[model samples]
Structures are given as structure tokens and as C-alpha cells.
Target: MPGNMVTSEFLVDVDHQRCRRCKRCILNCGFGVFDFQSMTTADSSKCVACHRCVVFCPEEAITIRRNPLAFREHSSWDVDKRKAVWKQAQSPGMILTGMGNDLPWLNVFDHLLIDACQVTNPSIDPLREPMELRTFLGRKPDRVEVVPSDGGYRVQNPPENNIELDIPLIFSGMSYGSVSLNVHKALAIAAEKLGTVMNTGEGGLHQELYPYRDHIIVQCASGRFGVHSDYLNAGVAVEIKIGQGAKPGIGGHLPGEKIGREVSGTRMIPVGTDALSPAPHHDIYSIEDLRQLIYALKEATGYKPISVKIATVHNVAAIASGIARAGADIIYLDGFRGGTGASPAVIRDHVGIPVEIAVAVVDAQLRSEGIRNWVSIIAAGGVRSSADVAKAIALGADAVGVGTAALIAMGCRLCQKCYTGNCSWGIATQKPELVGRLDPDWAAERLVNLVNSWSLELKEVLGALGVNAIESLRGNRERLRSLGLDAATTEIIDVKPAGR
Candidate 1:
């Protein structure tokens, strides 16, 4: 026997009395845990606890549980750390993980509390009052020049190009090869229905999505995958992806196993080849280089709104200021808790800061520099609920971007096995059999319901705060108080103590 054998994490049990031997569990499970020779048998070692079999069993015969056998308890070397070491011992390479960081770190949004109207101020009822959630994302001129027209006054200088959203929510980017085509179709349909925008990650836009071009934000990343003159002008806006929060300061790699004919055609790469994006854009080494690209994109796209996306780092405020000066109409800050198709375990859990702090610092810096109106800020990563949306606006974000939450509405169970390409839920897999499990129309309806529910909840939150419009809450930190937070943290987020 070999030393340091990796113990199974999940235990799968089969009840013969309840099981009909219909072989449904074998067909439903993508991880290949169930088999039948004489009777139904389960290989507990292969289970990832995805719950597909348990949910699909006709007789409810399958049960999955955590393995009771665990390593000797230790405070520093936890179960995950020990298991990781054991796995690396067998196949030595960088460890890869999917979804967001699963580490037990502090979530800043949980500590911050929103203030409501009390005795002095009267709260408005959302059902009775009109609450505005419409948001325009783009640059705004500091001053507008108006001239007298035949009927009235006309603005000689109009505002910069902007995209209007019915709700202050956007679907974050999840690439084509990383996720199934049905997932992309659902997101596009939902964005069109919600009157918002959806990002097409680094992967180029599939031809089927061309019809929804007016509601899309095409991305131009380090690899420049699928970028062309037609693709640049196809969307309402363009996003220049500098870095993603999950793996900051590193490149992206989509393994050859996931790249099929459709993905190859869309990304303009050959089939069965790994799609690798360099760590940094070769043409962009300085702020000046970024400015050139920004202008080049603008000149190519008839001066459409341009957004620059960056991972939230310690010096994010300074970096955002430079991006604003580089003529970007929007700044997208992705925090540490963002999701990804695949990323190194070390970077996803340890790198990047939270979006809350990034939003506060960037907004404050731009305001201090007298350029707050120069660009709109979109804060992404770790946004989970409607309350988080309201708090993000209060912390100075013009809008919030959501990724993992949308997937959960479409039946994702947070299994954290997205990188394996065996997603039973069909949200992260490229195989035809798994991808067919999800229907775009059904998934789109679920996503539409999710956003509509959040929109209503946001209006209720606004009514409780005695604000009829969401714009009133923008950058208003006085309405927030920090609880169970240190003095330094509260100061950094610009929130007062709970009592005060």
C-alpha cells in the first residue's frame, strides 16, 4: 500500500429496498459513482457530493454524506490543507480549483449595516410610492454647453455615450469554452429581458448571440480572442479586461478537452488546442499604452462607451485614477470573492482585496481629484443579495455585477467542481450530453425571476431608508454603520460605529 493515500471526502449509500434497479442513478450521475453488476453499487470514493443522483433518484434511494473518517485534528493544518498536500504528492503540479475562494475569510458586506428611517423620518411604502432603479453607466461631462433653439434650449455638448439599465445589475462575464453555450444563451436572453447588459468574457461572441448585440458588452482581454472590427462594434459597449479577481496578476488557460468545434470557431482558434492568455497584454505595458488601445477602440467603434476591468489590489485607487485619465468611461473593479471557470488554488484564495473597500477608495479618490464624474464605477465579486446591491451603491458603486448568484438560480449547487468539466447541473460543462440538461428558455425565465425579485427587494430597501430613488443612496456612507468591525476597517470603509 502507498503512504499518504487521499481519503474519500464523500460517502455514497444505496438502499436496495428503495432502489428499483432501473439504472436511473447511473445515467444521471456525471461523476461515475454508481454502477450495477448484480444490484446497484456505489463507489463512494468518486462522489463529489453534487446531489444530482440524490435529486434524480425515482425512489429516493441514494444518500450522500461526508466521510466520518478524518485526519487527526490540528488547528493550523486543516482538513483541506492536508488533503491538498496528499493530492499533490501523487501528481505534482499546480493545484487548480473552480468557483470563488472557499476559504473562511471575513466578508465585509456582512459587517456593514444599513440605516432605516425611524421616528423623525417617515419611511415610504414601495407599493404606494414610485422608486426609481434606472441607472446610466458611462462617463458624464463636467459641464454641458447649451444653445438657444427654435423651440427651447439645446445642449451643444451632449453627455458621453452611455448604456441605460432598468435595474442596477449586470451579469458578469463567464467565457464560452469554460461554460456551456446554453448558459451563454440564457444570460443573453435574461439581459435582454431585464434591459441590462451581459459580458462576453475573453471568449469571442458566438454567431447565435449576434441578435442580442444591443444588450451585450463584448470583452477584449489579453488574448484578444475573437476580436475584430465587427465584434468591437457589435455590442452596446466594450470592456477591456486587464485582470480578473479570481486569479490576479496571472494568465488564463482553457484546456483542450473543453474546446470543441463551436468554441474553436468562436475563439478563432483551432480545435483541440489549449487556449492560453498571456499574463499581461504585450502591447500594453504602461498607462500610455492602455490609453492608446482605449482610443483605438473608441476610434474604431464610433466613440462608444469603453470600460476597463481590473482586479482589486492594494493600490486599486491609484490604478483607477490612471484609468480614468486614460479616457475610460467606466471602471470595473473585481474583488477577491469573484468566481471563475478555473484558477490556481493559491491565487484564488489569497490574492486581491474586497470590492467594498475598492469601491469606497476609488470613489473617494476620484472625488478628491475632481474627476468623479469622469467615469462610472461597476463593482463586482462577492455580491450575493439585494441588500448587498443597496450597500454597494451606498459605498459608491454605480452598479453591481453578478455571476455565481445567477448560476445558482439555474440549479447550480455550489459544488465547486466547475473546473472538472463534469458539471451535472450543466452550467459549467461543454460535453453535449451534460449541456443538453439545461434549456436556455427555462434557465432564462429563472434568471429573469431572480433579477425581478431582487429589483423589488431593492425598492423596499430604498423605501425603508426614506429614499424614493436609488441615486439618492449613491456614495452616501452616512446611512451605513459598521458592527463587529475594527476602527481601522470602519475608517477604511468610511462607516461609523453602530451606536454612533
Candidate 2:
């Protein structure tokens, strides 16, 4: 009864003067926060500002606004900080959160400035001239063999293991259980249409998606859910998820309540079973162990390229070097601002580094170690736009992974309620009623439009730099400099301060 007591952190005001109570607001609300039996208006405490009830309401009577409770301002002990303390004191459990970190940290992306070509060096026209965005993810051979054959020289010793991407953008892993089937289908179709790749986020590939195998990249996380030889072969490349940026050094457990028939089938688990992913793979205790598994998967898939994904932690650069030496053809680095299906608020906000610094530091380290070309880098976490994608490539990432942006393109509002499975946008939720709201066909078009638009913007920047191809931007730090940053911070990102 104490917990059942209603609290007004947000205000839900209904203009009763309009008088017609069709109850559209209650019917549309999936949170079941409305008590119509004795209600004048929807409960304010449960209102997430999802705008569902407001959008579907027949009468323009209901309005949702925050209560805006004020606490005496204290810089050290802010309202959120004090409230967080009270929450834990009342119930000793980790605070559950969704999406990326909302904390105000140093976003290195803001300080890094990009360059444009001057009259001395003519800028290329992407509309008329050629601009290549095609990229390959995998190990490259040290040198090409020129064999004299008959009257002409013949090329030899080609690396069969590779994952060719028509564009430098990839849909980051968002599992089937975390999101609806329609969302997955949209990503698959978009990837196929764009000639890029979509990752099945630790969830097994659905039977319906088998047709899009060429554009699929299967992830084998610590849980190993839905992993099989067939699944390995189905994808052009297989990624081993060592850790996620949202919850570094911690395991994840999807509650049994979320498990549905489709999710069960895809994960090869029984219904009502909690899907658990451990912090570390039981077999992968060291770099050697990782190498063994990478080789094993490659062998199983007849030498398909293997990708090892790790969060951007303190020792990320050293860890990346170890992974590169361990024979992973591709290294996937996820930063602190990455989104998650669900994660502990403490971990999501506090763990890992930013993607900009991670990519820059790792790239510099790999180059110094003389193994930069041995493995491709895919920068992830908080890649919000094409500027991010272009900057990431310039920071030495071969490509970038976008999860939250792609979800938003499919109509997500970033309400941070993904853990509740009541996403009105129909992308994050699995509820049958809510899932029906999204049309795969429509969602795919939106995703295609988003990617194509961003790609065009990328080309525009490349043209202004007088670079005709995207590859020429990779590791070209000379084209970027800091606006105003500390010497130590600039040194970490390995970019020079403005004005030489």
C-alpha cells in the first residue's frame, strides 16, 4: 500500500470543460497508469510523455507536463543525485535504465574541427565526380604477389576472408527479444537494399530472415544463444561480442517475463527462461583462448572473417592490440554513450570512454604498434550523424555502427522506456498490440531514406576535402584539429590543437 500511493512527479491535466470522455487516452496507454473507475484525469506519476494518449485522443483535452518539483539548489548534491540516493535507500537494487548515458561528460566530438579544401587544392564534385564509400572489413595481405604469366603479370595470393560493405555504415546489434520482429525485418531489408550489413544482436537469425543472409552479420556473445554452425554459415561475417558499452564488466539477464514464442524460437531457448549473458566467456580466459575460438569459428564457417567486439574501457588500446594479435580480422569498439536494450543506470552512465577518444586512441596505438592494417576497426557508441561517421573514419575507423539513430529513424522517441516493453513507436516493444503499430515496409523505407541522406552528406564533406574516396579519409588526422582542448586530452586523442 505504501508503494501503491500515487506521486506527482509529472502533471497530467485534462480539460474537463470539453466533457466527452471517450476513454481513448486510457485505451491507448499501455502502462495502465490510468484509474478510470474514480479518475478525473490520467495519473501523472506514470506519464512518460510518450505522447501516445495525446496523439490518439479524439478530443484535444489532455495535456501532459512535468510537475517540476524544485529542491534547494546544491551543486554537489543535486536533485537527481539526492533522488538517486533516496531511491537506493528505499530499495537496495541497481537502478534500471535504457538508451545511452545522459550525463554531461566531455564529448570530444564537439571540440574536434574538420577541414575543407581551399582554392589552391580544387574541391571535387561528388555529384559529377566519383566518390567511393565501399569498404572491406577483414585482414589485408602484406603484399601482392606479381606472378609473370605468359606475356602479362598475374595477381596472386588474395585473402578469401572478407566482408565487403557497399557503404561505410552498419546497423549495430539490437536483438529480436529486445525489439519487435518488424524492427528486425526493417533493418534486414534496409541493409540488403543499401548493400551494407545488419547485425543480429546476440539473437539468432529468424527463419524469415534467411533470405537476407548475404547482408547479415551474426553476433556470438557470452550467452551463445541461438549459436550453431548453420547460423555461422548464414552470415557473411561472425562477430564475437566480448562486452557491451552500456554495461561493461557486468553480465546481463533478460527476465523470463519478456520471453515470447518468437524470441524463444530465435534464441533456441524455452519460453519463460531468462536469457543470461555472462560477463566473460567461460572458455575465453585470455588472448590465446580468444584466438582459439576465433580460429574455430573461422574454420567452422570455411574461413569467414571473425570480428571481436569490446567496450572502450581504460585499457582498450592494449586490449585492442591483443585482439589484433590474436587473429581477429575485425575489431569492434563500443564506447560509453552506446544504447542498450536494458542496463543498470549506474553502469550505463559511469562506465567506459567516449567513442571519439576511443577510436582516436586505439587507432594511434595500432599504428604505433605497426599492426593498424592487420585488422579493420568499426567505431560504435553514440554515432549520431554523418558528421560522426566521417569523423570516425578520419579517426581511423573503417566504418561506424549506429543503433540508437537507426531506432529513431524507425520512429523511436528515446523515451528511455525500452526496459518496460511498451514502446508506442513499435520499434522497441514486443507486445502484440504495440508491435502491430509498426509497418515493416514503411519502416524500411524510412531507414533507407535516413542512410541514403547521411551517405550523401558524407560525400559532400569528402568532396569539400578534395577527397574522392572515403578510404583516403581514414587515419588522416591532419584534416582534423582541436578547437580548444587541454594538452593531455588532445594528446590522448592524438589530434593537434588549433593554429599549429
Candidate 3:
């Protein structure tokens, strides 16, 4: 095949002498760019220029350069270069991509600054002083009637005490099949040590991790994979995943190649066929329909609190209010920048709203409707540090979810090669050899360290804001200011500078 004729082919030039046939390039390249046919090394025409092979090569033998002249003379510079070239080739037009969404984001972490106590007011010592990171997730009673007794006033028994976490942050859903068994084990162990929660993404809960059931939050998505009576009642809380921030309208697909014996058994599907999750739940068409499913799950689990997870999209405020009315006790808002195991490049790069705006709007709307206290709001997507957690809470989030940050703490380099199912870091892939590279003991400890570090920072931020507890910071817009915010953002967030 002519090199110019293939739009997907990489423009590669290799120095044969530098290549010792170590095959590290072939193994590390997620797109199958380099292949070994018999004893010779060969490069396929369909390379995406992910640069994994080039970076991993010991001898620096590989060079992948894009053809500058390939662009047509009349083609507009504004058009996507990759898409334009693909159209010229007239081959399969689909854009094959890997990893989560990559777009121009209004990064909440960057926009929102954390308040830290200076020399004026002393900050508490995280090691010695008691700084509470504990957060309550369920609904609080509307009103508590106090009865006068002989000694003092006493209130009736409060709502059933649900699971409590030492910290406000929880591990977001990523799934066993989407990630790896070792990754799941690391999260389970880490959650236990951190005294937090780890979500079993819609993929299904692995029976082996049942020992850490207290720390697990079982997820039920549209596919309902591995969901039975036991799975329903297995976790402290059950989360219903409606839409993910990476690809809101689309559903998940676990390729047949990655579906091993254990995964197949857990999912209760055949090993060699594509596991398809439908775009929408067949039984749920409206908010009322969603209420039915929530009630059904609650009944099956003996009234365990149910959480509804949704992508932070346009009009999220209205949708969140509907979810609150749908009998959900908790609401999880995933921002557009959230990571994914595998998603189309086009979809990942585009679609969905920023978490900062979504959280503000949803919290404001719920408060206006007098239902703000009805449900707890947990924000996810691009939550990097304790500063982010404090900022999110100040923007009206009750808590935050940490995924990419957690993975980075566990040694992920963010190569964005997760879709290929050959992660060198062993966080995204299930291959035994690659998975063995990760040590659960070390990985769990790193995760615990990350959370612990953030907790101290969170306390410092609270102290600077003149607040002792995080609950006081929740939705306290007076403490926040939108630096150089646009009119729309200013109007939405409803915050201005101290002097302005």
C-alpha cells in the first residue's frame, strides 16, 4: 500500500542498527504500531502517533513525523487536521481514539483558589489538633421535635446511621472490567486503610473484593451487569450511573478480547462476544420511571440509601432537582473533564459542561426549590488536590470524588493509552504480566497518603476561611470570587471580588 494513500498510517523512519529487536516498542505501543512478523520488525500503516513506542524505545530507533504536505491546498486551517486527512483517504471514517475526554476546559481547580490561614489566625496542626474530615451522605430530618424530660430535652431516634468516611473524598466508579482486577484490589485495600469508599463502577462487583464490602459502593448502570439480590445488598451504598462525564449519551462497551474467564463469569456473559450496554435504560424513560428503579433497588436492599450519578451537562440544575424528587438520597455530578477507560476521540474531546458551573447551578436551583437539604451533592472530574475539594465544597458540593489524582498517586503517568488494554502502569489493563507490575501494598499506601495529605490541606483552607468544619463552607458563595469571570459565568456563579 502507498504510504500517502493510507490516511491512518504513521510517517515513520527507523534506524535498524539502533533497534536490537528488544520489541519494547511493539509491547508498549497500544495501537499495535510495531509488529514482529517472523524475526523482522515491521511498522503498520495505521499509527495514531501516540508517541508511546517512541518514548519507550531504549535505543531511540523510532521517529514518527506527520506529513505536512498531506493537507489539501484549499482545506481551511480551522478544520481538524486529522479529520481532514481521514476524509481525503475515503477509508472507514470513524475516528479511533483512546482514553478520556481532552478538551479546552474551564478547569475548576485553576479557577477556584483555596483559602489558607496566614500569620494572623493560627492554623491547627493536622497531626495534633482534631480536624474532622467525617462527612454524612444521607438525608437529614426536616425538623427535630424536642421533648422535655426531667433533666433536659431529648429528641427522638434520628434516621438510620449510614456509612461514615474519615474523609470527604471517595473513589469514583471505574469498574473491574474497564480497569483491572489488581486495580480493584488496590482500591478496595486503599479505601479500607483510608476509611473512605471505593466505587465498583457499573461493570459489576468482583466477589473476591466482598471482604471489603464496608468500603465498597456498588454501582448499577443501564446494563445492570452482575446485579442480583446479593450485589444489590453488598455495599454500604448503591449508585445508579445515568451518564458519565466522558461520554454522556453513549454507553460502555467492554471488548471481547479483554473479557477474560473471570470477567466473563462475573458479568455472566459469554467470553468472546462484545458486551454492549444500551444507550438508554430500556425500562426507564422519564423521571417517574427512574423513581421506580430507585424504589425497587431500595426495597431489594432493605431501604439502603441510593445515589444517582449524572454527567455535568447543560441544564444539570433542572435534572438534579428531578433526581432529588426521584427518591435518590445522594447525587453525584461528574464534570466533563472526568477520565474514562475507553472513549471515542471525538466524543471525549467534546461534550458536557464544567463541574464548577454545574455544581453552582445545581446547588442554587435546589436551594431555591427548598430541596437543597434533600440530597447530598458529590462532585467529580478533574479533582486534583485538597484545594480542589475545598473549592468544590465552597461551590456547593458536599463532597468530591478523586479518580485521576488517585491513579497518579498510584504511579500512573497519564500516557492516555488505556483503551489499548496494555497499560504499562497496570492500572487500566487486565493482562497478567502487566498487572503484576503493580504492588497492591504500595499502591494502596500511596492512595492513603494522597488522601491524608489532602485532608490536612483541607483543614488549613477551612481555618483560613474562618470556618472550623467543612459543612460551614458548603455553598458559602460569600467566601468565593470569580477572577476575570465572563458575564455568563459571573451570573451563574453569583460571586464577585471582595471590593467589587
Candidate 4:
């Protein structure tokens, strides 16, 4: 066995005689628990018994046995582990974490299915046929009529208009302070290459990324971290992040420890001070207040389209309708199952409604109110595959924002330990060594590959639906059927039986 690092609450035993120090264990362990010393290896005593090292060792030389399992036996399996840990903490009962919203709600990814054409209809060969994934995001005209002008017929533009996207999927908001400059650079490059847009989530824009400003969407959250006149003018559109899917009622805190020199400088805050993003915007207390913020941003940015992002919870449909009438050009809905960088495990594992019900209800309500075209709907939270993207569009989303899926392509293991500021994957933490683990070139390529793959799959699904464009799938709920919906759910979602 290797020498002990400290008094052990948990320990890893490695048989040195059998261990060749091939470093397979070190390479396989997600948590860097083992380090080679002399001719053998030793444990760092931070092991959470993920067992990747023990399972990957070529020889049976490693074992991790916990010391008396600190957790008391629970009669109910419903208790959240992280919440229990928080309860055990001595002080500062706040749950600090990173990444997307984590919750055990009905995952829309699992509930929805993509309709693919079988024998009766032929799937178009993307290589041979033209398939469109273009999406327009903004308010559409309530009604349109062709009129003769001086020369020819023309259609009047609506008070608000849509911004056209080459693809239906967009890069979700991730700030420079929360992520890294290199990560932001990669996202910017990839968005430019893919002809899409990436959101600069609350974090201020870096001057280096200014050249790619045309592909960026700047976000204005409660904190207003990097908001300036020029920064507002930098993006194609502006998004007001009212509430994140994770930690909806709570605020965001980028601990002083994670606020490195670069992040501090970029966010324009003093180093070593916690970046506290308040839960609600002090100025926004109602829909009218929200409209003022929207107009303020629009005026600040010379009338750029403004989007309002909200967490999907109960009463979301009513809230969404109010948002549409609140002068927002677009409405982005984030469901409960979304991933977060760091959130209270308690908040992540509970709180909020599923995306499926939220999207359906909001769409139905908007259509019923004759305001479906008043604002574009962007569905987010736990969108996994191309199938989910297509299904979201079929359910009436103009586009979808994918965060966790994008990070997974960049080598995230979904470890749920990002708040510790020691992420091995380099996707969530601010540590220099952890950030160094990620190669921007490789990570960018992988993100591009993931998006490209999904785009192709989306085209395949559209082709299978006998449609050439993604727009055809929008709000076409007639093609969808509820598999086992209850009365309340069915009524809320307005899902009808097959052949309805």
C-alpha cells in the first residue's frame, strides 16, 4: 500500500507488489485521487469511491473502502445526498454549486419521441436532397396582406421582427467568469463556423471575442456583471435572464476563490470579492417593470431584439403570455431538468416543472390567445439528442438551447461536483490546472461535431416527417399523441389521442 497522506475518513489500498505503476488507475479515475510516489502510488484521501480507478486497474491492486459510512441510515430513499451534506455543514447553510439545473422531474428528453418515416414515406437523402434547418426567432406579424406599392406588391413588416438562424439549435448562455476565456473563444469560433450564435451569459464580453461579435448574444441578468453600452451593442440580440432553470428563486454566487485574475478583470469586479448575482432584478417587480428593462436594453443597444429567459415552472403558460405582451421579441423557456454549473443539490434535485408540460401549455395558451406569433419560443433544459430538438420544434419551439449536451461533447462526466472549483473536465471550474486539462482546439472541434451531428439528425427527422424545412414541424401538434397521459396532464398539455 502507498504511504498515507493524512488521517483517513476514507482510504484506498493499493498492492504495490502487484501494481506496476502503469498509471492506468490515475488516468481512469475521474477524481484525481491517486498520485505516483517513489515506485508506487498513494491516495490523496479525497476519494468519493467513484471506483473508476479500482475498476480500470490492469491488475487487482486497488480497493477503496469507506470508514464507517458517515451517512446515517435513512428509512426513506427520497432524501437528497447533497442536501444532507448541507444540513451537516456547521455554518453558511447556503448550497453553493455550478452547472445546470439538476432536478428529478419528468425529463422531456425521455417523454418525447421523434417521428421518423417508415416504408410508406421515404427519407430524403441529405447528401442528395436539400433540407432546411433555418429558424426565425422574434415576433411575427399577427396578420399579413399583400399590397401594391409604387412598383410592385410588398408585405408590411411587423412592429417587431424575427432574427433568422441557420440552425434550430443555439449555444446556451455560459459566462466568461463562470467558464474560461478559452472556452468562450472555442464557443465563439464554433458558432462562427456553424453560422449560429453563442450567448455570453451575464458575464461581460471579452475584447478578444469582439471580432466574433456578430455571432454572440449578450445576456443581461440581475447582476449585470459586464453590461456596458458597447457590450450591449456587441451581440446580434440581447437576452434578459430573469431566472435560470437551476436555483430559480435563489441568486448566483461565483465564490471569491473561483474569481481568478482573468475572470475578475473581465467581469470588472475587484479580485477576491464574491460575484453575487441577486435573485430578482431590483428594477423588475412586474410585467410593466420587465417591459421597461426590455426597452432599456433595446434603447441601449440601438433596438436589438430582446429575449426574456424564464424557468419553466407551474403557471408558466400565464407567465409566458405576459412576457409575450411585455415587449419581448422572444421568450426562452428553461425547464427544471436542465443542468447547472453549480447549484444547491437541494434546488437541483427538486423544484420546477418538466419541459414537456411547460412547452405544450405555453404554446397552447399563446395560440389560444391569438398571440402565438407575437414572440418566438425557445425551449431549453435537458435537451439531449437531435430527436429532442426536433420534438421541441414539433411542440412549437422556434429553437432550442443546449448546455449540458454541449458540455458532454467537451468531455464532461456530469459528476455534479463542479462547485468545488476542482473540475477535472475543465468545463465548469476556474482552477488553472483544471482549465489546462481542456484543449480548446479539440474541445471546439468536438462541440462542432456534436452540433453538426445533431443538425444532420434533425434533417433526417424532418425528411422522415415529409418536410423539407424545420418550419413545417413548428406547432404541428396534430402529429403528436400522448402515450399514457392522465386527465390533468392531458388537459394541461392539451395532448389529444391519435387521429384526433
Best-matching candidate per lDDT: 1
Task: For residues 1-500, write the lDDT of model 2, one tens digit per residue.
Answer: 36632245567788887637788787777776565664456777787777777777777778878777777899999777777776787788988988899999988888888899998999999999989999989998877788998999888877557788989989998888888899999999999999999999997889999899999999999999999989999989999999888888887788786789988999999998999989899989999999999999988989888999898999999999999999999999999999998999999999999888889888999989989888999999989889989889998899999999999888776778888888877877878988998899899999999999999999999999999999999989888889877899888777888888
lDDT of 4 by residue, 298-365 (tens): 77888889999999878899999999999888898988877676788667667788777788889999
All candidates: CA RMSD in angstroms?
Answer: 1.7, 2.3, 3.9, 4.5
In order, what lDDT does every prediction score? Answer: 0.93, 0.88, 0.80, 0.79
Which candidate do you rate higher for TM-score, 1 or 3?
1
Q: Write the per-residue lDDT of candidate 1 for residues 412-453, one digit (tens) a residue.
A: 988888889999989899999999999999999999999999
Q: Quick one: RMSD of model 2?
A: 2.3
Candidate 3: misplaced stretches above 4 Å? 4-80, 87-90, 116-128, 145-157
Which of 1 and 4 is ahead in lDDT? 1
TM-score (C-alpha) between model 2 and the true structure: 0.94
Off by over 4 Å in 1: 144-158
Model 4 residue runs over 4 Å out of place are 1-32, 39-45, 48-75, 78-92, 100-104, 116-125, 147-161, 497-500
Where does candidate 2 have its weakest 10-residue lDDT segment?
A: 1-10
Per-residue alpha-carbon lDDT of candidate 3 for residues 371-465, written as tens digits (9 for 90 to 100): 88789999998787787788788889988988888888876766576777877667888787777767988888888888888888888777666
Candidates 1 and 4, the one with greater TM-score = 1
Model 1 TM-score, 2 decimals: 0.97
Model 4: worst 10 consecutive residues (lDDT sum) = 1-10
Worst 10 residues of 3 by lDDT: 1-10
Q: Using TM-score as the measure, which candidate wins?
A: 1
